[model samples]
Target chain A: AQSVTQPDIHITVSEGASLELRCNYSYGATPYLFWYVQSPGQGLQLLLKYFSGDTLVQGIKGFEAEFKRSQSSFNLRKPSVHWSDAAEYFCAVRDNYGGSQGNLIFGKGTKLSVKP
Target chain B: EAGVTQFPSHSVIEKGQTVTLRCDPISGHDNLYWYRRVMGKEIKFLLHFVKESKQDESGMPNNRFLAERTGGTYSTLKVQPAELEDSGVYFCASSRIAGGETQYFGPGTRLLVL
Candidate 1:
């Protein structure tokens, strides 16, 4: 019954610009959050993950995300994006169902377009 | 280390035809998962396997789809009597542990059911 929502369908930003992709999730317990990126014809790559720890989590390629429990949001941010950052980004949540097997629920994804 | 690998990067078949997709997980991974994405939908979980046992298959849409992991190393997902609605990209991922673990994905198999 866990679900994730990504408000933006497409985001266009110029190179070197700061970027933020919004993500919200609904789950019963403390959630496991993750961010992934997928380039054309490539598999999904993990950007970052949030379990139980500091609110801010740093990821590869200079990307970061802050988990806000009050708002039920885990938004991805980058100080400066490069042209190669253009790709589809997905926000996912895993429910803590007290089981060893837990599947991830993903949002529809936000397609990032880095403009020159 | 090499990441997960899937066989037959793409497949095109007519409606009612049968298609099978294969996935070879990371060398030491024990947990493997299958997911699919329609043209514009989020990736949906199809099943999960721990070694050779199916831990969770609740996400499987129907009986027409079958997934098996033999010897706990690689997996295969077969869809019989494929429908147009089955056209999508099927992705396979693997993790070292069962729960709360990071999963690495393989390049998906694009299946088109005409």
Candidate 2:
């Protein structure tokens, strides 16, 4: 079974500080990875995805993630954190079966708190 | 373009009652998906529909849940004899058929079974 683990349940950071959220996955083979953000009272928004290519993938809202095959990790990072960036972040891996798309398996998510 | 939308932002019903949640995907999106998030748990997949066909329902919890995309445009998930453990936020998402891997999500329907 494929599963995702987001170690940080909650993270607090000062505004303008760099941010990094850890994510690890357990899968049989190379899988598609994604990052999503849920703002306060907002719908789930896609941040970025990695199917197969370069390790580093850039996403919307000035976010980026690096996929490390050896460590089975795809960590989300940002150079600076904003007060508005306080939200719930989820890490997920797509169930890829023979090049076809499958449902996404999400981690427990990490709630980010920005101290302004 | 309008994003996916779910009706009745919040619904509270007594246990053993029946409740139906509706989802209207983006116009022309062929892939519609259902997901649920129980309190303090990760959001999990319930099912997926491709043009009125059940593409994948492996994630559906049990027989009490039934999802149908009759016209392939909108979907309804009905839970009969709802249980208190079924309370959660149900989310609906949709994407285009061709090369549309990214699924857009709706605001979600928050259900509470008392």
Candidate 3:
């Protein structure tokens, strides 16, 4: 079955530190990948997505993700961490069935905590 | 433009009671979706609607859950005789079109069953 795995359940980082959140997916074919972030008491927000072409994709809030097909991973990274960036991050893949962009299969999510 | 909006940000009810959740998608968005996250589990798809039609409901848990979108506008998900396992955060999302469009999600309705 197609699934997304976010290995890190929680991570703590100091302000200004670099941040990386791991995400791996299991799919039969080339899939559309996405990263979403949800802040406290807020809805899920799209960070970035990778459809095709360049392996590296930039998203909002200074976030970027690289799609590594060989490793079956699409890890999100940020050069420097911000206290406001502390939130729950989820990795998702579009459920491609019958050539239609169906629902998304999401990972368990990784919670990031920023310490000042 | 307003993003997706869900009603009753939080609800608490006893087992065997019925609760209804509402979602109003962004204007001009023809596709709406319903998803749920039970406690620590990942968010799971419950159903999909294209306008007023039900496109896919493969993720619906069981018959106790009923979703409807009338006039292709706002949608509602009714859970009758709610069970303890049904307690979770229900999310509503909308997209302009289908094919790989970005889905804008609502704040979600957190339901608790005693």
Candidate 4:
């Protein structure tokens, strides 16, 4: 079974501070990873995805995530996060057993709070 | 291009009542998925519909949960005799094709059972 674990339940960072949200996934085959963000009272928005090639993937709104095979981790990072970047972050792994399916297993998510 | 849209942004109903959640996928999307987040936990996949056919429904919790996609464009999930445990935010998402693509999500229907 493929599962995702986001260690941080909540993270507080000051404006303009660097941010890193940890995500670890457990899978047997070549894993496809994704990071999504959800604002309060809003639907989730795709931030970035790592299907193949580049380990460091860039996403919208200055967000990026690195996929580390050895660590089994896909960590999301931002050099300098703006206050507007505050939101809930989720990491998902696509199940490939059936071939190109939409069965995404997601993490519990990490709530990010930005302070001034 | 319009994104995936779900009807009834919020619904509050009593236990034993029935609630049907609707999801309208993107204009030409062939795959529609349903997921739910309960008690602030991870968003879990409920089912997936490829056109009017159910592609995968392994994640559905129980028999009380019935999902249907009549016209292959819009889908509905009906919970008969809804329980308190069914209270959560149900999210609907859709992708353009069969591959592992980016799925656009709806605002989600927050179901409160009291």
- Clash-forming residue pairs, model 1: none
Candidate 3: pairs in clash: none
lDDT of 3 by residue, B1-114 (tens): 888999999999999999999999999999999999999999999999999999989899999999999999999999999999999999999999886899999999999999
Please give, for residues B1-114, the per-residue lDDT of candidate 4 as tens digits. 888899899999999999999999999998999999998789999999999999988889999999999989899999998999999999999998765788889999999999
**What digit string (tens of lDDT, one per residue) describes model 2 on residues A1-103?**
7889999999999999999999999987788899999998888999999988899999999999999999999999999999999999999988765433567
DockQ of each: 0.75, 0.58, 0.74, 0.71
| lDDT of model 1, residue B18 | 95
Candidate with top lDDT is: 3
- Which residue pairs in candidate 2 have backbone atoms (N, alpha carbon, C) closer than 3 angstroms, thus clashing? none
Best by DockQ: 1
Candidate 1, A1-116: lDDT as tens digits? 67899999999999999999999999867799999999998999999999998999999999999999999999999999999999999999975564437678899999999999
* Chain B TM-score for all candidates, comma-separated: 0.98, 0.96, 0.99, 0.97
How do the predictions measure up, each by TM-score?
Answer: 0.97, 0.95, 0.98, 0.98
Q: Give the clashing pairs for model 4.
A: none
Segments of candidate 1 deviating more than 4 angstroms: A98-100
Give the lDDT of residue B32 in candidate 2: 90
Model 1's DockQ score: 0.75
lDDT of predicted model 2: 0.91
2 or 4, greater by TM-score: 4
lDDT of 1 at A52: 90
